[model samples]
Target: MKIALVGIGKIAVDQHIPAINDSPDWELAATVSRHGSVDGVDAFTDLGDMLDARPDIRVVSLCLPPVPRFAYAMQALAAGRHVMLEKPPGATLAECHALTAKAQADGLSLYATWHSRQADMVAAAKEWLTDKRLTRLHVTWKEDVRRWHPGQDWIWEPGGLGVFDPGINALSIVTDILPHPIHVTGATLKVPENRQTPIAVNLEFHHPQGAQVTADFDWRQEGDQIWMIEAETEAGTLTLTDGGATLKINGERSGTAAPLGGEYPRLYAQMAQLIADGGIDMDLRPMTLVADAYTLGRRETVAPFHD
Candidate 1:
């Protein structure tokens, strides 16, 4: 399968490019980026130009931020190419739905990947939670934004999803491992004093099965940051740490495993299988939760943040 990559940013380099290089079924046909180039690969600064030039490109992986993903995805799907989207899909629920519709109309595959769901421990957590009755959940994702984001000013922009940058990973894992769906009951966002978007968020989730989940995400933590989820259930208290790479049950270490490799590679494999099997995989449940959180969340201004 001939594939093109859009947005040659950090993630595109750290994950997408290497994944494409390693995939046997996928060939990196072209790339569109404003300020980067890939050796031996056709490169263009404009997505439209690349699409027009490489008519044989059957797949397009959009690594751009959420701002322009919808339009690019629409164009790619309309041109009869399967599209893969990075997390958060689009800035809003309406845009995501529109892309889904466009993909269906064009008979193309749309893969909205939640990389956290592809973590090694996620499936194990799912299996462990299957028969257990969850009573409470606590999630904490605190990271040093300056160290991770650096000069990426877009992260603090209005639609850039400040704290949700890492929070969404927790949400994805929670959504995947839970036995039943959960709804946002309440949320409070802490916006930086100088920014229109939030830098931290505390959310409460309510499930029909009497589960109460609380998530706290902050972009201000320093040193050894935390990305952990703890669940209290009838069977035992389960703890997932290191962004779902390690799991423990009732204070005892349970497992330690890393994902096979890059998430994009696994995603492409899944996409290839979908195409070969004459089917599509589109799950919007997680995106819906994110949209709902944004719509229902309350906002408060906090101290100013600086890069």
Candidate 2:
């Protein structure tokens, strides 16, 4: 399948490019970026130019930020090419719903990939949680944003997701392993004094079965990052460490970490399967919960952040 990559940003260069190279079923036909290039591929600064030049491109992978991804996906689907979206799907729940409709109307596959869901330990966690009644869940994701994001200014903007950037990963895992759906019951966002969005958030979630989940995400933590999730259930206590790479039940390790493959490759493979079978697998449940959290969450001002 001939594919075009839109937005040659950091993620495109680090994960998507390598994944495309390793996949036999996919060929990187073209790329669109304002100021980035890929070797041996036709590069254009605008997505429309690339699409116009390569109408045969059967798939388009949108690597742009959530704010602009909806428009790009719409354009690609209208052109009859399957589209793959990076995490969080879109900036708003409404936009995601629209994209879903457009893809259905056009009979094209739309894949919204949550890279964290492709983690090696995710399957094991799901297996362990089967038929178990979870009592409580606690997630703590604290990282130094300056070290990871550097000078990416969009992360602090209105639709850039700020703390939710990592919080969404926790949500993805929760949604994948939980036996039932969850909804955000309460949220407290700590916005930096100088920014419009939150830099830290404490969220509370409720499942229909009275399962409680709480998450804490902060961008101000220094040295020794933490990404962990612990669940206490009737069967026992399950802990997933290193962002779901290591799994343990009742203090005994239950699984080993598998190789972390490129999430985009797996996503593209799923997209190919969807196209072949004439089906769609885009799940916006996680994104929808996030939007609901934002709409209902209370905002608090915090100290100014400096890189």
Candidate 3:
């Protein structure tokens, strides 16, 4: 199917373009971006122009930031096209719901993609934890924002999600793997003095089966980055590291390591399947956890972050 990519940012160039090009089910028909464009592809500065010009492009994949995603998604759905959204779906939960409603009303597919859940070992981890009796789960996600997102001013602004931008990836895995449901009980957010969002956060959750669940997210790490989740159950310990690309059972590696961009390929394949099945998979469990953190967290003013 022909698909038009909406944003041509770092992620679109690095992951989305490659995934679409490699997928047999999709073609890079066009792109809509203000400052970036793909080579040898029809590019437009506005989405409305792309929609009006190419009705053959039935799928519109939005790689834009969460703040502006809802409008683009609604526009695509209004044009009777299948819409695929990047992680977190939208800046607000209500907007996501409205998009879902509009998609259903229009009989078009709407996919709120969470690329992390498609990580190789995530399914393996979920399978192992399915029958086990959970005891405790801890998520430690830290990275240097300057190294990953340098000079991205929007991230420090309100609704940018700050540390939770990457932190939500861990939540996506947690919410998908665990057998029991969990919700936020308490949280501590470390907001930079000059920024609206938190640069660091410590989240606590109430597990239904009395398991101790917590997460630590910080965008101030220096050396080797960390994206690890350790889950303890009555059977044994299951650890997912390297953003769910690697799995360990009781300190020993258990699953085969997948290549770096495995997630995006699977995400595109899933989007194709969603369109084929005429379904909407707009899971908001991960986003809900982040939203609850914002609501329950006690903010602490930290030193100003420059970058």
Candidate 4:
């Protein structure tokens, strides 16, 4: 399938490009960005121009930030193209719903991708936990923002979602593996004094089965990064680490590591199948959890973050 990739930012360059290149079902037909482009693909600064010129490209994958994504996505759908979105879907849940409606009205496929849920071991972990009655599930996702986002100031803005940007990846995995639904009960958001978004967060959830569910997200770790989820159930303890790339059951390794390029390839494959089947996959459970945190959380101003 011919696809145009919009927003040639760090993630587009680092993950999307290689994933598209490696996939057998996709072609990087064109790009829309102000300052970034693939070496040989045709590029445009405006999405409208790309849609007009490249009608052959049936799919448009948006890698842009959440704030400006809705406009581009709507434009593409209006142009009669299938749409695929990065994590969290949109700045607001309403926008995601609007896009979904647009796609359905246009008879197009819309994929709201949660790449972390595609991690190699995530399926295995979900399968293992399918029959177990959970007693506890805790997510610890901490990373250095300077290392991952670098100079991206958009993240500190209101809709950028701060730590929840990466934290949502964990929630994606959590929502996918668990058998029952969960809702946020309480939360504490630690916002930097200089920024509008939180740099750290603690979330507590009310599990339908009365299990203890909590998540801790921070962007302050310096050394080894940690992305792990431990779930203690009636059967055994299941641990998913390395962002669902590895899984362990009761302290014993459970599966092999993911393939060379990891989650994006799988996402692209799923997108291809979705397009073929004329289906829309816009599961917003993870985003709902994040929104609930913001709505229910208590805010605290922390030390100002520089850079």
Candidate 5:
């Protein structure tokens, strides 16, 4: 299958391109970007022109910013092509849901991929939590924006999602690993004086099964960044660290922390299965929690963040 990669940003170059290269089910047919281009691949400055030139392209993999992702996915659907959307599919929940509907109506596959859910041990964690009775859930995700997202001014903007951007990745993992769904009960968001979005957030959530969940998101960490989650059950405690890439049960290391299979490679395999199965996997459950947090969260003004 031929894939038209619509964005050539850092992630596209670092992960997506490598995944495409490793995928036996898909190929890098072309790339469309105004400022970036992949080596040895057909590149175009405009999406429409790329679509016109590469009539063999069957799927459009969009890595564009969330603000423009919906429009580009709409265009791809209109052009009668399947779509593979990156995480946080759209700027708003309505647009992503509508896009799913549109894709179904057109009889094309639209995969809203949560890449973190593709972690090596995520499925194992989910299996472990299946029979266990949960007691408490905790998530701590903190990292420096300067080290990870340098020069990305859009992140501080309203739609960019700031700390919640990384926070959502953790959310995806938690949502997938848990045996049942979780809902937000309350939240506290800390925003920088100069930025439109929050620099940090603390969300309280609960499962219908009586598990208390709390998530802390901080983008102000200077060193030794953390991405860890803990689940305490009646039987034993489970810990997932390195953003769900590693698993530990009762302080004893479990199996498959880093899978022999890479996350993106598995993600592409998932896309292939979705395409073959002839359906869409657009789960807005986690995003719904994000929306609820924003709706109920109390905002606090903090020191202006720079960088």
Candidate 6:
């Protein structure tokens, strides 16, 4: 498959481009960007030029931010190109749903990818959780935005998702590993006095069988970074850390023959397999959870934040 990457931002450079180059199933055919370009790849100023120039690009993976993804994805789909969306597929669930429907009606492959959920250990954790009764679940996803995000101004803009940008990765993993579905019951968003979105969020969820889950997402942690999810079950404790790359069952590290395949590579392979199988696999549960959070959350103003 010939692939065109739509965004040349940090993630597109750091992850998606390399993944596409590494995948035997995909060729890094072209790119569309305003400020960045990959060395040896055909570059265009925007998607329109890329689409018009390289009609051989059968698939386009959008690495752009969520706010702009919907428009680009619609354009791609309209051009009879398969579409792959990054996490938080769209600014809202309704847009993602519309895209899914459009893809189905047109018989084009559409994938809303959660790269973190493709981690090597996530499947093992999900398997281990099967048939076990959970007592409680907890997610600790914290990091200093200054270190990770630096001075990116769009992150604070409307529909940028702020802390939820990274926090949604945890939600994606949780939605994948859990045996059953979860729905947001309550939420509280802590916003900086100067920002439009929250810098931290506290969310509560409940499983059908009455298992409780809580998530604390804060972007202000200045010390060690943390991204971990653990569940206490009647059988034992299951934990996934390092963005679900490492797994622990009952305090012992889980084993695997292939210890790791970088998340984006795995995601690309999954997309190829899904496309080959004539199936579209894009889960909206995680995105819907974020939407529900915005719907049900109460807001609290905090001290003005400064980068």
Compare the candidates by lDDT and give the number of the best one: 4
Where in model 2 is the C-alpha error above 4 Å? Answer: none
Candidate 3 residue-wise lDDT, 87-118, digit = tens: 87999999999999999998999998889999
Clashes (candidate 5): 0
> Could you estimate the TM-score for every candidate?
0.96, 0.97, 0.99, 0.99, 0.97, 0.97
Candidate 6 C-alpha lDDT tens digits along 1-307: 9999888988887888878888899999898899988888898988988888888989999989889999999999999999999887999888998999999999999999988888889889998898899889999999999998888877888889989999999999999888888999999999999999889999999789888799999999989989899999999999888778888999999975243348889889988987898778879888889889999999999988888
Clashing residue pairs, backbone N/CA/C < 3 A, model 5: none
Clashes of 1: 0
Cα lDDT tens digits, model 1, 165-248, are 778888889989998889888889999888877899999888888888899999999899899999999889999988888888
lDDT of 5 by residue, 112-146 (tens): 88888888878889999999999999999999999
In model 6, which range of ten residues has the least summed lDDT? 255-264
RMSD of 4: 0.8
After the best TM-score superposition of candidate 3, give how far the Cα of residue 224 lies from its true spot, in angstroms: 0.5
Q: Please provide, for model 4 over 1-307, each residue's C-alpha lDDT reduced to its tens digit, 9 standing for 90 to 100.
A: 9999999999999899999999999999999999899999999999999999988999999999999999999999999999999987999999999999999988999999999998889999999999999999999999999999999999999899999999999999999999889999999999999999999999999998899999999999999999999999988899999899889999999867866368899899999999999999999999999999999999999999998
Better of 3 and 6 by lDDT: 3
Q: Model 4: residues >4 Å from true position, as ranges?
A: none
Candidate 3, overall lDDT? 0.94
Model 2 has a clash total of 0
Per-residue lDDT, model 3, residue 213, is 98
- RMSD to truth, every model: 1.4, 1.2, 0.6, 0.8, 1.2, 1.4
